[model samples]
Target: MITFFRSFFNSKIGVALSLIFVALIAVAFAASDVTGGASFGGVGSESVAQIGGEDIGTGEFSTTASNAFDQIRRQNPQLDMAAFDAQGGIDDVLEQMIGSYATATFAESIGLGASKRLVDSEIAGIQAFKGADGRFDETLFRNALAQQGLTEARVREDIRRGLLTDQLIIPATFGAKLSQQLALPYASLILEGREGQIAFVPSAAFAPKGNPTDAQLQKFFADNGARYRIPERRVLRFATFVTDRFRDQVKVSDAEIAALYKKRSAEFAATEKRDVEQLIVPTEAAAKAIAAKINGGASMAAAAKEAGLEPVDLGLQSRQDLAKSASVAVANAVFATAAGKVATPARSPLGWHVVRVDSVSSIAGRSLDQVRNVLENEIAQEKLRQTVSDFTADLEDRIADGASLADIAKDEKLELQVSPELLANGQAPGKPDFAPIGAYQAMLPIAFGLEEDSGPQLVEVQQGKEFAVFEVQEIKRAAPPPLASIRERVATDWALAQGLASARKLADGIAKSSRTPAALEKAVSGASVPLPGIEQIRTSRQTIMQQQGRVPPPVALLFSMAEGTTKVLEGPNRTGWFVVHLTKINRGDASKVPELMVATRQQLGQVTADEYGQQLMAAMKAEVKVQRNAAALQRVKDQLTGRNREN
Candidate 1:
């Protein structure tokens, strides 16, 4: 899980949109931590880390980790904070933070910098800060930063650091190319084929029939207690309010509608639009000659095709719209001509035009009476926008003034709704079938981020129509369940463990003696218990690489082993072990497939570039002299698991 984190960030959100070092896995600050609080450790623990003279505060480090964990959750929903900690997620997050700081420090040492305008452009480019118009909006930007519980200064500084690192990292790996000679061997190896036979020794085959004693079960439970620990669950309390409540307060007046219609009078008026197919000749004589050919019973399309020209279809355009692209004379000539008729040649800035009208459409004009419903709907929407904006602003002010969800609910006559304990993905730990509904789906991310003591926050769940004011009600820390609850499972695990130990010995003997295919068959037949028959696998290296990392242990081993050699392999999830026998090897010549050779060369070149990036990142870190605060780091881990919540 931790190893994947570095690759994910470096590839998806790296420097200059092209990060390549495993040692540096920074997501930077544009990836907002939707969870409001970053209290991973105590509210204010000792500094989390020190990179050179700069100290990384607990709050900043925790925020970055929180953002990263949220990203990982999108990929693997079953993973919880406890499992994340156990899988070294904390260490990965810290490493990425260190990598980012080190790169920026190294950049600054050599006078590299990020200008404020460049930083502003980066911030503007973030989709989170953009409004409905698809441009940066100060309101949306401020709201986003506020929702993430981020300060303006911090976001700007982090973005600045990201920019500085990008300047240094991109040039270091500018252009890398692998020579044909070096790439040929690797490309040919991709086509190499192998066939192998695999025999399984099931752990269940050598089973321990009886269950464990109570004393033994108790010891096993204690030994693996952490495995049974439940992740932290949180209860969300919220109440939704629709725009209908404020609808009664807003009314669209007839005079206001009239004024709006008057302002956009051209939109309400009738207009003609035509579909035109046109061919422009470089000279007036050429266009006139082509027009005469069409007039003399020759098809316009045939004439154009014969002259090595294709007519352009100007799809559905109004007279004014056509005039914008062509000349006013061209628009007048095209619109005046009937559909299916050729228009007179008209000169434009580009050339002489020969146009044919394909089709024409007209929308009848509507008076105030005809479009009253449409006018009312548009007017109401605009009025409702102002109402909701004021309404939410007041709700925010009330929250700032120390109003709780319950207080606001009673004051505004809103009903409060409470949710069962939920994980980050909005599923209850005990109820696998449970799913988040309605506005709760959107609110869950925001709800989980909020601190328990924080006041209610209004989230625009329906974009403009619906919103929910919510706060965290309860937080249950992850911990082990009672031993009595899982005794049967523990006993089963102990039996499997015992059986697997015996199976390993049997598998080892078979592997050591099976020097030939006949000997492997004899060893398998000589087993004490009935086992499954050996299965043959034949595949190329390219096929295995195509499926990525889904190869079976034995089949993967077939390619790595000597033609006659055999090796024992453990099955995934402790199902059993396998004895892999390599029977044949087929070598490939990649030179015959030029496409494959070129592709392999490009891929190998990227591999070389990646290595260069990794080395440069390592050197920068060594110079920066990164330092970790053991006590501070542990407090964060302990805090995530609720082991040191009080600290």
Candidate 2:
């Protein structure tokens, strides 16, 4: 269960939100006078909100709020962050800020009520604080937390709450207080199981004879008309006008190309490249030691191993190719260092490193031939754009004047096709072909949104071979057939039902006469019954065939069975019954016996904190006598959405 919670929290969206929210919270707290009433960051004393005596100051809130805003910005480049402040996404951020505060406060309160010795022990055991010799390193612990903008006291408080919340949540979700009747079944079914042989009975085996009489066909169709009904569909036709089409048709002269190329010469210039390698160490002391060894004529490989650094063989790269954090220090150092020379005690944001430059290449220029192909391609693209634009303008005028897409396709020498009933997301007939000229997505909105028999919409869409037009030829409404039309289908189904009943009767009679699987087999020998060739069927929901067109229902009901017992289940379509005999029983191990225990305790603590926050919110709401201004919120939301739509 704790695994489930962690998995949920670790999902991409959840992790992103949690990380951003937490950082914002950390900043908010840091900027405030929360720790011992002393403001370390000088966020000055303005509290935004308070939970359980903990102040959420403006500095803390703003830092966190700013980070949260940035996170949102990175995800949606089009979002106007100024609107975040206006629309109460900021308020939501503040609420999360309060929740974090509440969790910390409640944990502290409960932990103090419990014991600090356990919390301290738990903290010491955390692997993050372990040194090379496996002993607890106080300096490392303090430094790591400080890097994350958390103080020792704050981290300890978080740990205490985390542990306490786990203690509170575990029992709430799963407890030993269940009654005997419920517990026995849960234990037996989940912990214990049965083993048996299974013989599958295929549904197709009992199908009626071919060319079922008109009466029978009619009956079947009537009974199952829902399966055959066609979904609602519409016809569509569109023309897309793109800038590229016009751009392609606009011819550029040799003189113009030469002039443009000259103006943008830097864009075509070759970039400087560096070949480099590194031996990375976590500390400046270690990096210095490694540098000394390298300077003493020790091989880079030997020095790296002694320093416990992995030798990263970074091949040739341009400055543009390196990430920002490693670009300047690593890239610059490598390019500047002489070939076969190693830099000493080099530091980058990632860590301390000793750099070695293998070689560097000077910037070069491209020849006319090398750049001619690019220029020619650009010229053709411009021409195609102009052509397509002129064509679209002509087509749109024709369409507005009631010209058919087929006629337009003929006139323009463009391709045209139809699509099957499509959904809002553009799932059409058959498999979708995303590549190739003819394979294209249908305009799903126009196809599904328009009324039936609406004339072909003059729309442009991509299709196989090239972008083309489509003409929805017709519309089909989903409707089931009447019962009278499929009476024969019902009669044949009714006959199969009777056969199932007879098969069940035979199996049950055989079951009662025998006490075990062997005895049951022996008693049914003269009845020409086939043995189910199941080697390891331990659960009941497994289906098995007894004979042609007949099956016992107990196949799936086995999960509900008890050890050393027998059960009967209803067969498919009321066709027959199953007499399931128990053979061997096996129950898998109980989950989270030990390791999950720790994780679960943590998860439980988290839940407890969450619940406490909920209670706090409820109390706060009640105390404030809150009444929402729905009209105002809606008006604000509408205005915000409108602005976003415009963007």
Candidate 3:
């Protein structure tokens, strides 16, 4: 039963399901208990979904959504709330929660449930709830629950439901296997090789008869006007306040540093450590014999060699480290031994061991003078951060009272600057030379998100360092300029298009006449413009892809053709064309390659198992009745998007 539980918990499905409950567990530790009318039973009428008669309440849905949003924000700080909603992040969170509840209901109906004792054991093993002594502490667990606004009853129920769901799903999904007959074909295709000769026809070789006329350039520009249209751009006038500007104004007194040092004195003290070598053997008697030999006349290395054991150097370890790596008994015996002396044999979980303490470093504490500079800098930064926070808050209040950004900048003596017309990516027209403030990269999204009518607002530039208040001074909507304004660009594009058309015609003629490598080389040498000769090279599909240069389209065409055939393929970016001749093909034999067959089998097995699991889950979902509260879902979305209050 223990082995089965271990395997089930370690499976992919187990890890994914466990993460859901673990996230709830983390929330429980971080929030205080939900108060007022928002308690569990009071929120039943706010159910956003009902699965198998199990109501998933709005409070639970909101908590889960908020947690997921915070997690994604931490990973990608630039992602805005609008983008998060557009990506269906909210629906994903809702689906996961509903599915888990539905599966748990199914398990309960089939008489599957975990005992309280089992749940308690699982909770005890969680490292997050452990105390400094490495044992489960009731105080720490209660504190965590209080912080996360969760009750013990709710957390325990989640864990029990998670375990029951795993019990039902693991055996059904992970026991799937595939036959060798089903895996061999894929393995063969993976190892197949082909040899071919390839030649390029450069577009430059087929230049147009002459430069295009003004009328032709204008026609081309009119036909492809959308391709040259300028994107919408915004010009913003802004002022920034940075924390580093006030760092010199803050003071850190010696008395304050002394008090902080005294409060955290233990951090300065180092534990005594010893460098030791241990020799492990299979039996207690053998260990005792070895220890005696080492203590008497035999050198430690010589005795270890005689016992056919290699000594392990455990470098500069403390008592705590030894206790964790080996056993408490071994740790105690080693710490009691004097430096340059050998300890008696001690029995541990590994077997038996003899130890020699090479040297010991005594516990020492750093003097206050040694860390004075670091402490002063830390205190100064803390004060500066507080000052920045207070300043930004006051600035926001002033803005909320309808003060113009320009007036605020003048009154506060802050630098006010206006940006050139810039695109959404913060690039100017014609790639003009301009340098923006360092924080502009972080502020671009906020600036772009604002509407023309929106008032000035404070934007966080750098976390705890800089803030900016900005408003759009002008807007440039996307549109195509007149052809005369960009004639040079239009002419360049027209010439390339004409050149590519000529090159394609020439390539078709060469492919028709050149049946073999010798015929292709002769055609290239006789061409009007000089071209590189064709080379017959032996390579595989994988090899061509891994080479440095751009892969020609012929590489793919050659693999699809039969032996002794020729074809013309268009090159990427209209740079040229390729004439390919297929010479030979080699199909992989499974008997000759064993490693590839094993890998293919595993890959096929995993894919089959995933498909099987999906099918089973779909069937289960169909059997269960689900009713979604559309009104409640809309309300949730509105609340998340800050639109409910507006309505």
| Candidate that scores best on lDDT | 1
Worst 10 residues of 3 by lDDT: 1-10
Q: Predictions ranked by TM-score, top down?
A: 1, 3, 2
**lDDT tens digits by residue: candidate 3, 561-592:** 98888888877656688889888888877756
Per-candidate TM-scores read: 0.74, 0.46, 0.53
Specify the highest-TM-score model's number: 1
Q: lDDT of all predictions, in order shown? A: 0.77, 0.53, 0.73
Q: TM-score winner between 2 and 3, please give it.
A: 3
Provide the global lDDT of candidate 2 against the true structure: 0.53
Better of 1 and 3 by lDDT: 1
Clashes of 1: 1
**Any residue pairs clashing in model 3, and if so which?**
29-144, 30-147, 30-148, 31-147, 31-148, 31-149, 32-147, 32-149, 33-149
Give stretches of model 1 more than 4 Å off.
Answer: 1-85, 92-185, 226-232, 244-327, 331-367, 478-489, 589-629, 639-642
